[model samples]
Every structure is written in C-alpha cells, then in structure tokens.
Target: MEKTFKFTPEEFRTSVKIIQYLRTAIGSSLENHDEQKVRKYIHQAIVAGHVHRDVFGLNPILTSLQTAQIAVDEIGLHRDGVIATLLYGSVANDDDHEEIDQLFGENVARIVMGLAKIQKLYEKNPVIESENFRNLLLSFAEDMRVILIMIADRVNIMRQIRDVEQEEARHEVSEEASYLYAPLAHKLGLYGLKSELEDLSLKYLEHDAYYMIKEDLNATKKSRDAYIQQFIAPIQEKLTEAGLKFHMKGRTKSIHSIWQKMKKQKCGFKGIYDLFAIRIIIDSPYNLEKQLCWQAYSIVTDMYQPNPKRLRDWLSVPKSNGYESLHITVLGPESKWVEVQIRTERMDDIAEHGLAAHWRYKGIKSGGQMDEWLANIRAALEAGDNMEVMDNFKMTLAPEEMFVFTPKGDLFKFPAGATVLDFAYRIHSKIGNTCVGGRVNGKVVPMRQELHSGDSVEILTQSNQTPKHAWLSIVTTAKARAKIRLALKETQVKDGLYAKELLERRFKNKKIEIEESIMGHLVKKMGFKEVSDFYKQVSDGKLDPNDIIDKYVEIRNYQENHAKEHEARSAEEFEYEGPVEDLSSQSDDVLTIDQNLKGIDYHLASCCHPIYGDKIFGFVTAGGGIKIHRTDCPNAPEMRRRFGYRIVRARWSGKGTSQYSTTLKVIGNDDIGIISNITSIISKEEKILMRSINIDSHDGLFSGNLVVQLEDTTRLQALIKKLKMVKGVKQVQRI
Candidate 1:
C-alpha cells in the first residue's frame, strides 16, 4: 500500500485555529479594514500541511498565530497578501504534508497551488537551460497571478525567517534569499520588502562579510547620521518653501550590492556614492502626480547639474511588476552623483508591494491568470542527467530583457550575451539545426560571435547541411545545444544500425555467427553507435578496419582490472579521486569537460571493450594505437574472421594502464542533423573519443552514424535510451 499524508488531531486543529487570532489582531491593526478574505486564507493553512515535507517540530499554534497577528499589525490586509501568507509553502509536493483542498474553499486553494508553482526562480540547472526558460515564459503567458503570490509569499517569509531555523540553516536560507529572492522582490516593486530582504539575506549568505560591513557601518553611524540630517534639511526646506507636500529622506545601497560595486568598480567606500537619496512623496490626485514629478525634477535640476543620460521615465511605461517612478541622478554638492526618485504615495505602494500590492487593489479576479511557466518549472525534475540540467538553465534566466525586432522585424528577447545560434533557435529549431551562418545588424558574423543590444539577426541555412560537430562550440543557448546533440546522436545510431542490418544481410549468406560480441567489438573499435554504424561508414566510404581490432582487445583487458581495483578502494578515497569542477564517475570521459590538452599523448581507441565472453584482437598503428574496432569489424573482418583470426585472440596478459575504448552507433528515424546528438553524447562522455561520424536523410527520414569512444561497453550502452528518446529518432544499437 502507498503511504499517505495525515494530520494529527491537535495539529489539524491548531493550523486552522490561527485564523481567528489573525482576524482579531487585524481589527486593531488597521483603520476600518475588511477581514473576510484574510480570515478565509488563514483557515486554508491547516488544510494545506506545508510543514509535512522538509521541516517539522515547530509549534504550529504559537508560530502561526503569532505570525498572523504580526502580519495584521504590520502589513494589514490586502486580502491577496493575507491569502498568500496563509498558503506560503503550502504545496503538497516537496516538503508539503497537507493538501489545501482538504480545508479551504476552492478559490483560495487554487491560488495557493499557483503560488507554490512559481518557486523555481532559485533552482539551478547548469544544463538544459532552454526548457527551464520555455517553462518560465509559458507560465507568465498563462498567468501573472502565480508570480505575484509567490513574490508576496517570499517577501513575507523573509520577514519571519529568524523564527524558522538553526543558525547555519538560517544563514543558508538567507544566502539564497540574497542571491535570488531579493532581486525578485526588487523586480516586483516591493521596495520595503526588497530592501529588508536584501539586508537580511546578506546576514545569512555571507555571515562574516555581512557582520564586517555592519560593524563598519555602526562605527561611522554617529557621523553618518549627522551628515544625513544636514543633507536632507535643504531639500526639505526647498520643498516646504515651494508649498509642495513632500517627504525627503536619505538612502543607502544594499550591503551585497555595495560590495559588488566595490569589487567590480575597484573603488573604496569613500569613492562610492555616499549620500542618502532624497525621496519626495507627495499627497496629490493620481492625475496631478505626473506634473508634481516634473516640478520636482525641475527644482532638483535647478539646485544641481542633472546628468542627461542618468534619467529614467518608468511612469510612461510601467515595469512588468507594476513599478513606476521618476529617477534622476544629478551632479550634486562636491560633484557627486546623487540619485533622486520622485513619486506619489499610491505609486510608492505599488512599487514596494510588487504584485502583491497590485493584487490588493486589483483583486484576485483581475490577477486571475494561471502561471504556465511555473508549471513547467514544477516539471523540471524529469531531466535526470547533466545534459538535461544544462539544457534547462539556458532557457529561464533572462528576467530583465526586451525582445526587440530585427530589420526584417522578427523579435526574440535574449540575455545580454546571446549569440547567433541562440538567435537561430529562437526563430525555430529547424533554422538553428541547419544554420550555416548569420548576419547581425546587416553584417556577416561568425555564428559564435556575441550579440549586442539593438542588433538584428538573420540566419543562413543549407538544405543538405546538417548541424556540424563544430556547432556546439558556437551555440550559446540550451535549446540549441539539446536540439543539436539529439540530432547528432540519432544520425550516429542510424548509420551503425543500418550497417548492422547490412552486415547481417551479408553474413546470412556465409552461415557465420554475426556474433553480437563480434559485431559489438567491431563497431566499438570504429566508435560507431551500433554495428550498422561500421557498415554504413564503410558503405559511405568514410572508415577503415585494420587497426581497430588490435586496439579493441588491448583496451578491453585494461578496463576489467581497473573496475576491480576501484571497488576495492575505501569510500573516502573514492570521493576525492579526481577533478573538482565536475564529479561524474567519468568526469574526464563520461561528460565532456572543459579541458585544454597540455599535449595529446593518450588516445581513447574507438573499439570493442572486449568483455570476458568475446573474441578480441589488437592492432598496431602510427601516432598511436587509436583505432580499436571489433576483431570481426567488417572492414577488418576478412583479416580476423579468415586469415589472421588466430592472432586476434589475446588473453588477459599483464595489467597495463587501465585504459580501453568502445564505439557506438545510434540509428533511428531521420532527424535534421542527427549526428550532432550522437557526437554530443561522446562529448558529454568526455572520456569517449569520436573518431568519425556521418549523416544522411531523405523523404522525411534521417540517419546518423556516430563513432562514440568509451572505456568499455558498460559506459557505451548508456546512450541507448538517450538516443531513442530524441524526437524523430526511431532506433538505437551498439556498433
């Protein structure tokens, strides 16, 4: 029987009971505030057991009740915010132990579900970035409300983070908050929350650094406080004299942000902008706020020389998060860059509250769209390998970007350094796979060249041209990477698979065992995905057989002994055995690594990883014994299967270097540039050598024969499902 979640009688009662306490506190917290919706949201928490997952043992009654009261006293009730507070971390997945459906009204429960979905802005996927990005876009396209609720929930949670964990855990949470949540809050226009979150998160992400800065700030607090008072006096007096109802104040940059500036700009604290900014919040009709903003700008400019380029007009086109403010960086007293932001009280609320603040005014009905991108994020767990993780990373992280149009007027938004291949994939996968070249802003550029803001891009394609082996070096986006790799793998498998069919077709007449072992050994030597890869390469006029068998046999024995020796080593030794940047078992070979060869002395022969049940052979070659094909490799079959067959059988002699090679062929239905994926697997397997590969397709069919080099067949066969999963690829086999 499957295990299910259940709440103890007391826990269920306490989680929901906090609502009455919160409602009671709100009556005193605000001036004539409405509380029906706020109460409803609080009641939903018990129904949604958020703590049942990752954390436990907190006093739910005391914590929830106290937190709710604090929320009422401090933030008041923007019904949506209140609802989000109750449902924060409420999803049934991850650490969530309860279901909202059990205790809340459907409307409240649904919104809570949506809030839980938008949590991936923090998770990292170093590969498969495009899928993550695609999910983000689709989520936003589906609903903006999900993002709003999530942003609101995080801002509120950070407020109480101190109550949630041990010292180390608190710091970890804060660091995450600083890096991801704080920026998100800033983007959403939650100014008060954004500032506090940034400061608080810093206290956790880097404790020593955070405390050092705090101590320094404290040391100079007396003098700095006096300086702020004097600076704000003139601005206040001028605004008062002008009869404009205004508030002037000083501001300091976030600690982390200041540290980043110091590091990047290579400047001392004294060199950085030290003035507390003056904000003029006036009481005016919404319509009058614009005129007041201009008037303030003029007054400020009159007092100081305003930098022409350091001006922003968000009022005209509000940010996606609903933030709007007029900003100007002026040349102030002592020629300093003093930034001033002017806005009305209402605008201030929207900016500081972000989507949550918007929901307070707009109501859930207005903000009721579903966030599909968040749903896609929820689906991210399906990508089980490094390849998939990397793919997801490239897709989702361009939050502050614009998708402008090119001369022909096509549009796609890219992060600051997107390249031509990124542009091609943005247009369409087909365009990217067949892309031969590109034009950026009407000038021909190498496909790998970086794209700049305002540059229009055009792609070039070839009908017969498939994605090349060199394309991965140039493609910057995960979508492009995944597509190219998939296509290549499909092509390699097909070539070898077809070759396998042909060999079997020929061997049927000879009445000889087209031994799976022999065929595997042969294909492995040539670095084909399957036996078909060898046949197809031979038939296609791209491969030779000699030298493959000898190398295949030599490598097979080396690997067996290595595995045995490795298993005998202690676990501690196993943990620290290799490179630090990547930890895969075959970090050097399994997944392609970032390596600049000091000198190419070693060769991972493309041959059969001669296992115990197989007939093996060895061959001598120039440069090195690099080509390890099967003893019965078709091209080498006549030599081994006939005349020199006896010499091919070599037993386990002395234990040389535990190095070996095997090849694979991934053949399936034709796909555009199927060879890319095949080769990518070799690249990802970094240990595997890709000696040679070929591609061909016609009439809705695609075939790729790839030669993937590996230490042994164990690592080689890892590609079967991966290749089979590629779209349009019909089959995969060992070569």
Candidate 2:
C-alpha cells in the first residue's frame, strides 16, 4: 500500500562511514569493535528490512542518519539518543524491541520503544486543537533523551521537506514544527534550533510574508553589517584596553521573531528598530564568569549612554530555564537604541543549545536551575492530570516573563501581568488560600494588584480566610488556580457529605422511610438535576432538612397514591460496566457520546464538564443509563479508586452537531463598554449563543462568568483567544 525503501550498496557504505565517524566522535565509549558491530547490525537490517518512506518520499535510512548527526553534533546528545535515532525505524513491534534489547542494550531498546509509541500516536492523525496530544507524547516518552532525539529528527525532516512536491504534507509538517517542536526547543533552551525551526515554519506556512522580510533583510544586509561593525569597533577597543579575553557577534533577530514583533507592535518592517542585538561572549574561569560579564557591561555602558530602565541583570540570578546573561540597551552610532548581551562562554553555550549543553557542562543529573524545572515537570506528570500538566508546562514555556522579589530578596519569575495573589500562590498553597492582601514596596495593595519587575512583595494572610468562589478569577498562575480549585472541591465534598448525613438523620427521626425511587422523583420534581447539587444547597443553609422532609413526605404520598409515569434514578444508581485494567483506548462497543448519546440515556457530568472532542469515558448509572466525564476530571482519581467496576469505555464517533453549554470566567479592567464589546463578539460568532452573563466589579476591575453554547472545544478555544484579544479583557478560562 505504501512505498518502502530497501537498503542498497550505497547505504551499506554510508553506514560504515557513519560508524567510523561516531567511533571517533564518541571517543573511548564506542571502541573499534563496537563500531564495527553497530555498522554490521545496521547493514544487515537495511539489506533485509524495509522502511516506509514518508509522504515527502525521503528515504528513512538517510533521514535517520541525518537526525543522528544533528543529535550528536548540534544537540550534544552523543550517546543513546544518537543511537536510538539511527535504529528507531527498525522498531515496529515487541519482538523488534526484544531484538534491539538483546543486540544493543536495555537503554537503547527503551528509547526505541518510546520513539515507536510516539510514532503510533502521530499515526492516529490527531487534530492539533486537541492540546492533550502534547501531554500524551510526554507521557509516552519517559526519558528526556527520547524527546531530544525526536526534536533532532523533526529538525532534520524540516530541513529536507523544502523541496517536497506534496504541498499539503509539507504544510502539515511545517505546522507541527512551529506549533510543537519549536516551542519544545525554546523551552529546553535550544535558542539556535528553536529560531531555525520557527523560521522554516514561517517560510513554508506564509511563503509571501517570509520572502518579504527576507528580501528586506537582504536589501539592507550591507548597511546593517556596516552599522554593526561600526558599533562593535568602539566596544572592542574598550574591552581590549581593559584586558578582557572575549569575542563578540552581532546576532540578527530571526525572521519569524521579527514578524511577531511587527504584529505585536502593529508596525511595518521599516518601523521596527533594534532589529539585532550584539552579544559579547567572554572567556573566563568558572568563578570569574560573573566578574567578567559585569566588567564587560561596565565597559560597554561607559562607551555609550545606557538606559537604566532597560537593564536586565541575570548573572546574580539566572532564568529558571538556566539562561544567564547581562542585558543593556544603549544609544549606538546613529542615535538609535542597540541592545547588548554579555555572558561567559559556558553561559553562551547553554543559551544556544539549551538542556543538552547544560547537562554536558554540568554532569548529567546535576542539580541546577534547568534540572529544577525538569523536576517540576516530573512532579506534574506524576500527579496524572493531563490538563493541569499542560497548563503548568505551557506557563514554563511562556516567552514574556517578569521577575519579582520577596521581602527577603528571594527572586521569582512569573508570566507578565501576574497579580499579588499569583505571587502568594507561588510561595505556597496555604499562603495563597489564606491570602487577604499584600504589601508591595511598603504600600498595602489588594490581591488583584498587578506586579511589576523587581517589585518587593509580602503577602498578608488571615487565619480564618478561606478561598472564595470569586478568587478563581483573581489568580493567574496554573498552580494557584489548580490549588484553589482543589480547595473549593474539598470544601464542596465535605459540605455535600455533611448535608447528606443530616438529611438522612432527619428522615430517621421523622419516622419517614426514604425510598430511593420516590426520593429521586421528589428531587427531580423540585427542579434539581443532580442529587449532589441538592446537598450542596442544603449545606449552604439555603435548604433546611425539615422543609425537605415535608416536601419528601408530600411527594411520597402523592407517588404512593398515583401510578408511576416515568423511571426514577436513585442517588447511588451510578454503575460501571467496563474492564478495570487500562481503558484508555479500548472499547467493547463504542458509545458516540458528546452532549447527548444516541439510543442511550447519558448526562454529561458537571464536575469537569466533558465537551465535544474531549477524551471521555462512560460511567453507568444505577437507574440512569450513563454519565460521561472528561478523562482529566478533577474527581476521576477518587471515582476510579472507589468505583473501579463502574467505569466503561467510550469515544466520540463523528464531528459534533449539537451545541453544549459551557461557562467562561473573564477578568479585566472595568472599562466603559467593555461588557458590550464582549457581548458583541459573542453575538457575531455564528452558532455560538450566549445564554447569560454575571458581572461583579470592585476596585476598578471586573470579573464575570459568561455561559455560552458551542459545538466543540476548538471553537471554545478560539472564542477564548478572541476574548483575550478584546480590549481590557485580561484573563479568560473555562470553568
């Protein structure tokens, strides 16, 4: 069905050459005999086996070799990652994995397995809108090397797809490169590779835009180079006179980044200044790196008028991603602003290569800033909530960030516009939940006060303060929101259980027998859809048990006298009807579940709100047929642990047609006509209907929840993005 590439004589010679080069490059770890064995194994596999070429018609063998070369040379992944890249295509099944294990080693086999699993995931042709795909890929790849190799492979593929005849295939590849791999590279600190991937993606996706910028840069190359040289000449002389051992390069901004800046600044190419930054990389001893960089900074500032407000000193405290540098903006030769960056050689290497160089210079598994970030990722994954993991992971990957400080001068970084509550949560969950206000720079500020760079903050807490429902709209950090959600849930559960016990005790004292069927009917007659909702109301003191007994008695008597008209579902009627072991992808008989299920009585759970195209499973209800829940539902862990047998496999069968009700929480400045603007956008959207909106305003800011009906998560995400772009709209989230 698909075209396959079989090994030829030329491939055998190439394999031998690759082995020889790797042996020398890898040094004593790969001896002559080991190299020969590797070459022999590759040659035999190629001669006897075949690999299906991609849509671009590139030979898998050549692709693998190129990826291995990039992994080893560019990414500094010289061990199992390189080997795994070369042999990844050979792994198709368990037997192949066993063979690899026996031939190479367990580590290589494991990497191969991980690579194959990710390949299978991609083969399923998942839509990009499903953000869970990234989390799934991460879950499959346990070792960081697997991810590094995959990134290398993606880079190699992007380099080759330039000439592919298949336009659609090439476009898809480019999108994946930009949307997935580029962000990964950026997060891992591979600035060079990240920029390359972004530029390539832009070239393919927006051919005209890419060439327009490229042509502009080409037309001005002479002048730009001349200006850079003129600017560097003076700095070079000053540094040389200071006896500093260093080299400098004028690094031009990537085309993709320039395009982004153009869009963000709402200006054309001619209007964009500071198109490049000058980097001064120093050679110094480990202990003297800070000294040298500061010296260089001083020398440069002395030569030019430095803008104090634009100064960024990262040497004292590096970025969480392990980037250390001193940044300053100064007036250069034409009275134009020029950005200058100063760092030592080691710091420069890490800044260019990211995690790979970090691990290489510092031994593997060392405790560093980058390692700390990785460890946080591991902890999030271990928590097993894909949505939460994605939220936290995306925050770490955010580009625009601001660093704030504690009263004790401890530095912390947060996404731009992070508020005082976000700072509190960043310190600890308990402090966040109890945070009443904050003292920012010796002035008392509200929790909603936005923080700025270098702001010294001290959180004010009250012992009796608990998280309010409205607090969800105040915090911006994912960790804070997740913790607040948890606290709210714990409070709900405790109240619901207490209310249920109180109601049961009242029924017993009233000498009234509580019948499941009659109670279910009575609850529905009272207009409550979920029994949990009824208990929540009772716990809030809005409903009294004495009044409930009176109503239940009235309904029970009426039901006893009249014949039943409809089937009633009990509170404990929920049941599970699927296998207990791994139900992630297996389905005995698929139920096309969305907002509604055909031929089956199913209700979407309110706890996590499973929308169309969401990863979902069915929980059989006692009298009710089923209830669909998102796989990442907040209550899923406890439900699965306590009611293992009630879980059933389910999936969506087709594109969703029916609209589902969802709520969004939005917070922003309380500007005039802001509400009207939001409503206008919603009304303009086709097939998107807003049912209701509630707004609360205090202290020049407003927070509101808008309930809307939409077809699926993709549309929901687009709507959220649009709302975020709305004037004065600061934050938006699906509740």
Identify the leading candidate in terms of TM-score.
2
Cα-lDDT of candidate 1: 0.53
* Winning candidate number (lDDT): 2
Please provide, for model 2 over 604-711, each residue's C-alpha lDDT reduced to its tens digit, 9 standing for 90 to 100. 888877778788988877885898899999888988998878987778765666677788999876653566668889989997878777777767677888878777
TM-score for all predictions?
A: 0.44, 0.52
lDDT of 1 at 473: 79
| Candidate 2 residue pairs that clash | 189-354, 573-622, 574-622, 575-620, 576-646
lDDT of each: 0.53, 0.76
* Candidate 2 lowest-lDDT run of ten: 569-578
Poorest stretch of ten by lDDT in candidate 1: 362-371
